[model samples]
Target: MAEQQTDFDVLIVGAGLSGIGMAAHLTEKCPGRSYAILERRGNLGGTWDLFRYPGVRSDSDMHTLGFDFEPWRHEKSIADAPAILDYLHRIVADRDIGPNIRFGHKVISADFDMANARWDIVAETEDGERKRLSASWLYLGSGYYDYDEPYDPGFATERFEGQIVHPQFWPEDLDHAGKKVVVIGSGATAVTVVPAMAARAAKVTMLQRTPTWMFARPAKDSIANFLRRMLPEQTAYRITRWKNMKLQSLAFKRARTKPQKMGEALHKRIEKVLGENFDAEAFTPPYDPWDQRLCLVPDNDLFEAINEGRAEIVTARIEAFEKDGVLLSNGRFLPADIIVTATGLKLCVAGKIAVSVDGEPVDFAQRFYYKGCMFSNLPNLAVVFGYLNASWTLRADLNSDYVCRVLNHMARTGADMAVPVLPHGHGLEEDDIFDFSSGYIQRSKHLMPKNATRYPWRLNQEYLVDRKRMASEPITDGILEFSRARQDQGAAPEMAAAE
Candidate 1:
């Protein structure tokens, strides 16, 4: 029998927002490079599909959250999960890229065949049968969500709980109506679940050790809608996207440089709704804004719930869980019929895939990120990581175009491998992947990718700066070492003709 060959020029992992957007980019920017997407799940839309919890929606504005190429024509700037899923489906259908995606193919590992300049991918089908595929480049579109198992804090143990639920594994039939509910954690999940359940529940309480800053934004973008009606589709989208981008950038910088100023403004906004009872010390986070992501309550739903006395906030440490409810460290008890542990997501890097380079196990943390996409010493591989500060798709769009540019540059040079190499004594300070204080990131501890001090190596979370570096920047900066193909036999018969 003839040897099995690598099937595509690029093999994309995970079929979510990132994966779909990547496919669209490759289709438009590098039409000649054939690619295949391997999705472990039987369906598309990663987070929008998996997260079935109540009020699942984007915290960021749709103007920035939506793709650069696609226009978000919806009235609601903050979209629900189903709507987002529908949007993704429409894009896939419109671009005619659905056929290229193979569902139920879970990529477990990738062994780089450097001699032949291809990757031998090991994946298992939905039926648990092992299979292999290969590609010239592997783009990891698998997001950082911990799908297999959510993070259990190991501290909230109780013997006589009615029901303890994690939003990740929310039961469809678990009705919360008329029942007293207690949501644990101070992050976006808790904020969302509280009000959603409050609408039907007897009473809801948000229990947090430390409070997170919450702001209210309009659910619908009236200005964006007006502009869309007045101007062309792309033009309207460009204007709205940039407007949000600049505003977000400015706010983030102000939060960093002037925490007190931002904090005061936040307190004032909430006080206008809650009046005098709103506790500044209780609601105000110890860490500054952008240290942990600020939570957005669209149309002030969370505040409305609080104002209506349907939901209440309790800022205290949990001594432990009791039979009926939770016991506070400061000698207090909160009753609950249902407990929702919206603690946080467990960060997963590179989809937790065991990747090797030329038969050697890749130590990812030791390596620095090359422009937040490619890793140092890693060849022809780009991992899709988004902005820690801004909307994820913003950075994702940049990454997609940059990846195509690198591929095109390689084709022009007749190069098969493009690896990042740092010079000796580059004198770059290594930094953490994110400076956020969320429990998930803190628990991850050193497992995340590193950042260098200097240009090209240090990934900028700023979109304005990225526009110059990721778009107009030259590829041949003496960092990316390019070379010709090692061999020609690995490519599939269909891809054998590609440059």
Candidate 2:
């Protein structure tokens, strides 16, 4: 193999929210440092750019999703996909960050060179050409969603006759109007698809293996709009962001502390709005609220669609797909002209790229998560993963800030590499990280971090705790070690223990 060459101080994969955030932070904090961001798709905005399904909107409030330095000026609190993509584009163009981003480049593998104390990254282009680049630091922000493929059931390809489509890979040419549609799965995507398709399609049926707890909220806030006009953008943004944070935190606390009472109150609210004829069991989730993400239905649109007779909910396991539609395990066959498999996504850690250290592949499955960023044995490589309970950007922002601190610390101390070293006999066990039985999460259990009932590994969704740990706390929490390289040889372990 011929050696291809490129170099950078920092190499970031995926130009989505986290990738862009990482680039912005690095450029601002470490000026004159050569860095590049690689994006697989032709455009940016990872999830927003990929999913083009009808009525696509964020599950979280826009205030929290928006960048801290950049205020989201949308009229709606829960923004549509296009709006979010536009915001990202504006940020990229305004900051002149586009130059640093190399679109249509997909990273295949990354190997850490122990002797040189650098990472060699191999990326393939859309046309099948491959190139290799070296960088001192490598950051993975590829996100969780799989871009090219859908998670269809094994029997789907041969059995289903109707046009089957996944929300993530929705074809632009396929038309859903005037047809009977059946959307599989019960989550944010399924809830969003049913109502939107119902408007144009003859009828839309949402097939769920299990019921999800649905909550109704306005897409736009009158108070937020008022404040935007009355107060400065920064002030309004901060106020709304913090206010939503507090409300969400309070809700989570109430749900956990007084689960029975909170569940009853929520059940009553759903019954009152959905009416006497509504099947309460279909709308109520079996598990406690927040155990899985609470499904947000904008303006009661899904329920309204159901009430209007354009949409219906079927809470049953899909036994298999038939020639015309899906067959339920109970022997009922629902006919559909089109099938939308909103059946969740595949969680790909670090975009499923092979990560190696010193020419040896590192087993992330055996590693413990340090501050949810650094892996136990991986050196000079940090991953940005967000909170499962709060807005993803909240945790990602903290990770970016901390990475900057790490970079500054490295440069100031003349260190070539810094990797988190877990104490001896420390290993994550199964049944501790994710307790959910959801197929997407359960299948990827080995690639994810286990949340112990302790600190760090146990993910605390509270922003205050994350803020104190990432920004205020010392880096030398006894888990990470930094080493410097001399002119004659490679990185030598210098013990300036993190205080």
Candidate 3:
């Protein structure tokens, strides 16, 4: 069969926030260069569109979550999913981004055409037809999460008699009104589900395998709201955005640097809210705070739901699922008409795309990360990783700006490729990057990036430091090497290998 082929200057996989951001920057910085964003879903806003479970809101403030050029006009600092989706849609339309987006095209594999200095991307359409495309550059902004897989236990779906659902794959028609609902997992998804489910479900029980350090914060600040009304929207947004950004950054820094003090303060605040019903032992996380993602409750709504008897918290190991519900390790069975597995998402590094340079596969396990952007030996590609501590967009935006600078520098210098090349003996070790044993990061440790020392590998989550390093630094940093494409002409290989 003949393969259908299309050509572009750049081919972007996943039309999510990052991909859209990339498109916006590319169009603005390097015009007349063709680029196309291929999305698996029929719409934009990746996770926002994919996840429909109730109480979906940005855990981070919307001001920081939104693109810097675009101001988030929502009344609430922490806006819900629908509003976010709308914001992304508006950006897509207003920026003329839709023309560059091809919906229902899922990237199956991307292979580097060594001889041609290009990428051969293979994708499957919604209709099950396969197509091939080539691009000078391939940008993978797919985000980490796997779209199809649910992280429930081995026997989760088979053993559970009740309707089992994963929030990532939530069914719009699934009924929960007046039915007893059991939400599994203790991350952001579970925190959001419990409160939303409690409103309509007869009772919502949060079943956790382990405890998460959760804190209550208002979604809408009274002072910010008053200022928004009194001051201009843009001015108010700038002030609130910077104010929240600094405050959150400081809080996270304190939590990481002086954990005991900050943890104690957070614990005390949580205890005050829970009052006599608080189970300190059950609620306190085993690891230090921020080791795992912290759970955020907007305006203490989750606690309110629990105190109102609409929700209940259960901390126990699930031995198995019974005919009607979940059986705990202690042999106690909790009846439930519906079960929502808010288990974490599977992280797909570089959208599981195989990366290679000159017929050699780039072994990410051995390669060290340079400034948390480019990896050693992989030319012309940089992965944008966000802050583990604050809003993801804050770091992503900086990375995007840095990418533009690098690309602009390359164009001006006549360099065809740029890759991070750390000094010999400077490689990251596994232990330095992550110490936790939970979620996808733990499961995919071997595949993820790590830091060996304080510089590039250390992953300094501080915005001030990152801002100086990423934004203000020269594009031609010594660590990052730029080179022109090889002039050697050769035929294409029979089969491209995976990384």
Number of the top-ranking candidate, with TM-score as the measure: 1
What is candidate 2's lDDT per residue for 1-499, written digit by digit as tens? 1123379889999998999988888778888678889899999999888888999989999898887878889999888999999899988888778888888889999998766778999999999999889899999889876676667566555676779888887899988889999998889999999999999999999998889877888899777898999999899988988898888888878887887777777777667667864797787777888777788888888888888999999988878788888889999889998988888887867887888876677666766667777766677888877766788888778888888888888888887878876555455442366545567777788777555466665555677678877777787677667775444363454322121
How many clashes in candidate 2?
A: 2
lDDT of 2: 0.81
lDDT of 3 by residue, 39-132 (tens): 9999899878888888888888888888876778777877898999989988888878888888899888776655566777778999999888
Better of 1 and 2 by TM-score: 1
Model 1, span 1-499: residue lDDT tens: 1224338899999889889999999999999988889999988999889888899999899889899999998889999998899899999999888988888989999988777888999998889988898998999999986789898888646564689889998999999999999999989889888999999999999999899988888899988999999999999999999899999999999999999999889888888888866878768888887788889988889888998999999999988788898889999999888999998888878898899876787877767788888887778899877787888898879888888989999889888888887655557787666677888888885777778667678667788898777777788878788875556544421111001
TM-score of structure candidate 3: 0.91
Superior candidate under lDDT, 1 versus 2: 1
Q: List the residue pairs that clash in candidate 3.
A: 451-457
lDDT of 1: 0.85
Clashes of each: 0, 2, 1
User: In model 1, which range of ten residues has the least summed lDDT?
Assistant: 490-499
